[model samples]
Target: MARMLEISKLTIRNFFCLREFEISFQNRGLVLISGPNGSGKSSIYEAILWCLFNRTARQSRVDDVVNDIVKKDCQVIIDGYLNGKPLKVSRFRKHSVAGNDLVVVYDGENFKGSPSEIQLQLEKLVRADFNQFLLISSFIPERIRTFAAATPAQRLAILGGILDLHHFDMAYEYTRSRLKQYQVELASLEKEISVIERNLEGIKADIDYLERNKAKKKEEAEEEKHQLVLEKRRLIYRIKQVQKELERFQKGKAVDYEAEERKLKEERNELSSKLTQINGKLHSLRQQYHDLQQIEAKDYIGKPCPVCERPISKNLVHRLMQDHKRKMSVVSRQIKTAEEEKEEIENRINELQKRIEYLATEKLSQEKARIQYENELSNLRDKLSFVQNKIDSIEKDISTYDNLLKKRYKDLKKNRKEIDKLIEKQNELNHKIELYEIIKEMFGKKGIRFEYIRQVLQKLEEETQKILYVLSSSKLDLEIEVNNKEEIEIKVYRTGIKKRYEDCSSGEKHRIECALAFGLNRMARSFHLMSTNFLFLDELFDRALDVEGQEKVFEILQQMEREIETVFVVSHRPELQSQFSNVVVMRG
Candidate 1:
């Protein structure tokens, strides 16, 4: 019923006047925070505000937030719930620096960002800001007159903020910002679309041009390829012919001219040697014939007597002559035979010389013809290789053209797909721009936000009157008026007599402000859909309200225990402690 906000725990260290403090507010109600001056009674609630919004009731800077005596960094940790979800916040401020740090965990997630951003996130979850907390959920003596003392326009604005109407302003601005972003994106997409269109046109022209040249180049390559193929065939034929001619030249038994000449020269030398031996033998035989004719057996008989010193007989001489004649006849026949054999050998040697000369001439002519045929064959093969290389080059050119055509087609297809995607993105951006425009109008001040304020203004007036009556023991009634311009003026009535807020006594004014704050807190929870559950009255009982007035205020706040889980009453009065079921005491 109280929007489910609960501060279950608060821990403070070296913050403000308190050196170290911790308390649990779980299941607490109507708590009395009693302490002497500078005992940090108000600091308890200030710590909560500082943890939630990085602001305090006192007009102090960040450097002064740390305890003066401790001279240490200030830290505040708060564990709570927002809309029934767990919330934890830790705030820190260094004594020597002007920077304040914040960390938040909401619904089991650590809120991420800078200190300022985390503060905004916490404010968003609680549906309240520092001003709203001061005006609605808290009644600090220092800020008590802020709302009532403001001008009509300022008061209207302040009430609107307490009712959580600034969220509409943020939404309107965010929507307008989104709309501008979409418009810019759409413009950029249109430019992309235009560039893509031009590219597509260029691509089409390129494809057309390639297509025209493609056939012409292919035809030229085919013709050249055909001519090369024919040339290669002609070279092949010529090579085959030359090879056949070369084979014919090689088809002879290899001649060894040196061996033939050696054999002929050896045969001639042998025959000449035989002729000389025959001539020598013939001369010896002739010499023997001449000696036999010149000297008969008489000389041989005398020479034998001289050699042997023996007598020669007439009969022995006659017999020796007959033997010499027989020897001479055999020698003459051997001479004739040697002369005929020498003539035959000389004729064979002359025939061998003529054969060797003919062999030398034939070998020379054959070698020249073989060399000519080999040279012709080598030339034909080189021509054939050159023609084959030309054919291969032409084929490669044809393949290159085909690959180029394929790549061009791929480019054309890719460009077309890119154009389609751009068109789709353009449509999506246009629709988003249209939707954001409608949202912008809806979140404007005079739109749904205006209607909500109108209805809440009535409920706020009624609730304030109710609370004021209870707080004043039916002696005080409150009326809230709103002009056409949304300016507010609070009117108070005492027993049916109208009294101006400025004219009321201090006690009456405090009661009226308290009533108004309570009404706004209730309206914020119920009508504005904000989550809240705590109310802080810092020295509200000690300032101007008498004992009876304090009792009335306490009684009404006690009644609020059913809705608000925690209500902190900061006071130094000892008599007030007996009235509360829960008492938290702080000492300086």
Candidate 2:
């Protein structure tokens, strides 16, 4: 059997709409917290919510809770007893940051750890957060008004919260994420193994080629190098013979190729110097012409000519203009003539360069016989180097192929073992994937997600209908069930056909809301979520309710007291003040 919690006292200071407020709730039957509209009735429950959950029923920001009149630190103090043992929960703002606030909890008169730690203990004791507490212990009439207006997902989420099966949705999402991660890892491993297999294939081909040719290749290379050495010795003898004859011939047949090249270079340099001087003179004359033209264009009227520094009259301006134009024409012709000469000089220099190159080529032609003999000598040396390299390479291959193939075969064997292990792991992961797919189907569809939930819900439907029948004692029976799409549907079954919650009248909807709210409270109390006791109604009787609907709500309240320890009904109405046995009046 579970123990019931009894809250004895609550104190608030500078919380929203509450400044220096305190109230006590005894462990008994219905206790009404009655007041007018602005009498801080809602703040009473909000303070209790803040004490237990570190938040308010409205989910207001931390900064919004500090009463505008107080301008001071906010606090909520709740002292209670759990199964006759003393317990206290207090929360107060210490600094601006929301998480920086402090929460202290006491068990049997001893204070515990930090805010977060104390919150964990408090949650264990209460078994409900702020929203869950409201759903189970509190009545909010806006739910009936807004049910048809909420989106399908939002409606489903609301039903899920009441059903207390939202954790299954979170679990499904987590499992799917893990399955995706495993698949990614398997793909990466497969890619890595493929690269290893390719390397193994290349290594095997090299090993086979070296193994088939090693001994025979070594013998053939040694014989070939011996023959190459004999030919090299004969070529060396011939090279010395050719050099002796060539040196004797060069001593008598000399040509001065450098002196002729130097004369051609001197002629090219003189032409280049003349061309540079002409370009410089042409540039200077062109700039003077431009200066005079700018001076003439600006109307030069009663202004001094910029170039001559003389006072300008009409006649003087005309003369300056004609002079400038004549000078400009002369400079342009000079520039064109200079450009022509520069081209001629460039061509002459190119011709001289070609002539010098021709002389060099002629000298090279004269030494062709010597070059031919040297080339023959170089060819013999290269052939010797090639043969020697062939002999060395074959020896190295014989030694290295044995060591390399041994190492490669060892690596190949190791890779095969690793591949076997990966295959085993892959098989296990495949089995896991199959299980996860089934889980996805169960969690995603109505197959098992609703199957396990249906048992609890079917019993709940009977319980709700029983409570509704006891309240009205009429032929109308309520049905609450999840459809094939896993959506929660609420209906009334009075006639042969069924009617949805949306089609019901305002009063009938109010009655349904009462039944569902009481049933939820019933669920929470039975499951030890709402202290196994009383219910709290926040302005439910003040809504647009007819006399019959109000009577039905009172009946639900009567049921609350009989089923639990104590109940609270928060209302602003004056006529219903005498209905409750215990009442605590609130002041604005």
Candidate 3:
């Protein structure tokens, strides 16, 4: 059981769309302020918001808003009461004022405080900013639209502001950031896995190449070793052949051994005899030859005869000596032939010895070549073994790399799984965040507790639906419910079947809006009546409600007014023109 609050008077001078106006309130029944669209019906609400909160309904810049309404020098004054107490607040703009250049004043006898002090007191009473209390036409529509259109983050912010759930929003954001970090980490791990896999592929290629080349080199080395063995055996056989030939040469008869002996003895004897005989013959031939040399050709003929005294004729002596000389020349020719034969035999024997030596030396050279070849083969085999061992080690290393790569991939998969889980958790947190926002927006800070606010909203919705049904003559049984997430769902029960808001017609939608407004008005009236006894509604019946709906609203307002101290309905509706106690008509 509460009373109604009254506004004693309100004066405006160049304030918003209200150029110059003044209005007064009565603590009685309905008082309608009737006007056209631009006749400042809504300006009164904007002025109230500005006077109390130093802001406007449009959320425009303070300078632009002030300039649009107030002149260079003007002021706005609002006077009201809370349960028979004097309340006063004034705002003005001066020529020297630059930005938001408005002043506020408050004079209350109960709390003899300054304007700032009065503002603080009012804020405490309203439990919200003054601008927020006046839910203007544009404000309501904009809020509904924003709620429907904003992104999740924006929605969360708005909800946090409304519900004072900043902590929840912050926690949700932190969790989301952590989830993003984990996702990035997972991506990096995947990239590393790809790089490792590529490296493993390259290593495999190298291993394959090594295996092929190693096999080929091993085969070639073995073949060379076999060839070396065969060459060594052939060298051994050749050495044996040379050795046998050398032995035969060493054991065979020496050419000209006996003939050389005989030639030596005969030559020695002949040399001695020839020396003696030539010595005597040389003396005789010198004397005779000198005598023949001293003679002329004609004398030489007779000189030969002098050597042979038995023949006085030259021809006769010459012929006898020529015969003896011819016999000696024959003997000398035979001796020279024999000496040449002995020399030829000696030369042949020397040549055979040299040939034997050369064959033996060549055999030794072949053996040395075979030994070198064997050593080379042995060295090559050792190198090939070493290379094979290296290849094996490389293969083992490649295997280890493969295992390591597998491990890395496994770890990457594990990281990805962790990221996925974190993302899932993040999504859950996001849902919770959305839930918190919806709760806050529907209910204020006082209704921050989800379950309690949900119950209250449910009750409000139910009362609204009942009011709608009454207004609609029960042709529609409006059903209201609070969904799982605390959202309001309204259904029209027609023909024993429930139809959602979407299934309703335009007129029905208008009725729903009117019903909701009346329900809120009733709630506000009850709350305000606790300390006051007056309620004022401006343009409450602008919806396309029928005559029956209007009558139902009027009846409700009348009943509520009696319960409270007073009620004021401001509207231009012809149906409600005669229903109010007082009427004020404004024209541009």
Please report the candidate that would top lDDT against the real structure: 1
Q: Any runs in candidate 3 off by more than 4 Å, and if so which?
A: 1-6, 64-70, 83-85, 95-122, 130-132, 135-448, 524-539, 563-568, 572-576
- Local distance difference test scores for all models: 0.78, 0.70, 0.55
Ranking by TM-score: 1, 2, 3
Ranked by lDDT, the better of candidates 1 and 3 is 1
Q: List the residue pairs that clash in candidate 3.
A: 2-529, 3-529, 3-532, 3-533, 4-532, 4-533, 4-534, 5-533, 5-534
Q: Itemize residue pairs with steric clashes in candidate 2.
A: none
lDDT tens readout by residue for model 3, 1-588: 432234567787665556678876555556677777777666675676666676766675554434364445445676776545556766665444532333332343344465567667666654554422542112243343353244534643443344335544455455455556655665565566566556656655665665666666566656665665565565556555555554443454233343444555565555555555555555554555455444343433544345545434666546655665665566555545555555555555455555545555664665565566556555655655665565565555555656655665566566566656655665665566556555444343334445543554455566676777777777766554444554444556765677766667766666666666555444433333233344546655756666676778877677666765545565656555676667776663
Over 186-284, each residue of candidate 1 has an lDDT whose tens digit, in order, gives 999999999989988887887788777778888998899888888888888888887887676566422466567678878878877887887788788
lDDT of 1: 0.78
